[model samples]
Target: MALRIPKAELPLEVRENMVQQLGAVPENVEVTWHSPKVAQDDMEFGGEVGAWDAADASLKSFAQMAVPALVG
Candidate 1:
């Protein structure tokens, strides 16, 4: 599973702190920093949904995309 956190809202120092507190970072986890313009473009192209909703939609889309790869 992937986790997306808005870097602008939570700075890198905070994220590093959390990682340090956690003691271990999973291999499956990814941290991405989205620029304001790129983020806006993503929302506009996808749907105008709230964060959680957009995340759900993205996950669903990823799962669907993965089906063929998994089968082949």
Candidate 2:
């Protein structure tokens, strides 16, 4: 039988912030947030890592999306 995963619920404020920034809560954010402390730290770290502006935005987005698929 296939396993069923439960839906993630973010705090109302966090949900609103994520939606405002991304247009929706990304599945990656939900999955990465399985633990509150880890999720908080991960999101903060992701913000820091995502702030480098030298690279072209389009290229960086493509690379970020591609690397995970390639690795997996």
Candidate 3:
């Protein structure tokens, strides 16, 4: 069981916040983000998310992130 994500894809604080919001997500389960990249209009954006616990496991995710748009 392990959590793997591309480096810098997510920050520790953001990950912690997700854990807090999504509760405990089992390891090994593959989660797919429908809208990985979202537009920030007025500094806000949202979309549906999905996670597969197993072949017989499915969930409807209403995850939304409201953060200041990062400027590179």
Candidate 4:
């Protein structure tokens, strides 16, 4: 879903490792990063990064939420 990672909190290497384990590139999946300033928005918080089934109902739910959040 909408995943907000503070770049300062996660080093590039860690993110790269996660991407490899997830078996997807950043372009292949939905993701977003926010600076501490923009991160203050109420609508942009608690985004999580993890593996999700492409066909799972829960994944769909998060996708729905993530797409719009990232788009707007």
How many clashes in each structure?
0, 0, 0, 0
Model 4 spans > 4 angstroms off: 1-54
Question: lDDT of candidate 4 vs native?
Answer: 0.49
TM-score of each: 0.25, 0.58, 0.26, 0.25
Write model 3 residue lDDT over 1-72, tens digit each, in one string. Answer: 444642234446545766797684323121332223321221132222233234422322312222323321
Candidate number achieving the greatest lDDT relative to the actual structure: 2
Query: Can you give the lDDT of residue 39 in candidate 1?
Result: 45
Best by the TM-score measure = 2
lDDT of each model, Cα atoms only?
0.52, 0.81, 0.36, 0.49
Distance (Å) between predicted and true CA of 7, model 1?
3.4
Clashes of 4: 0
Query: In terms of lDDT, which candidate is stronger, 1 or 2?
Result: 2
- Pairs clashing within candidate 4: none
Cα displacement (Å) at residue 22, model 3: 0.8
Where model 2 places Cα greater than 4 Å from the true spot, the runs are 1-5, 54-72
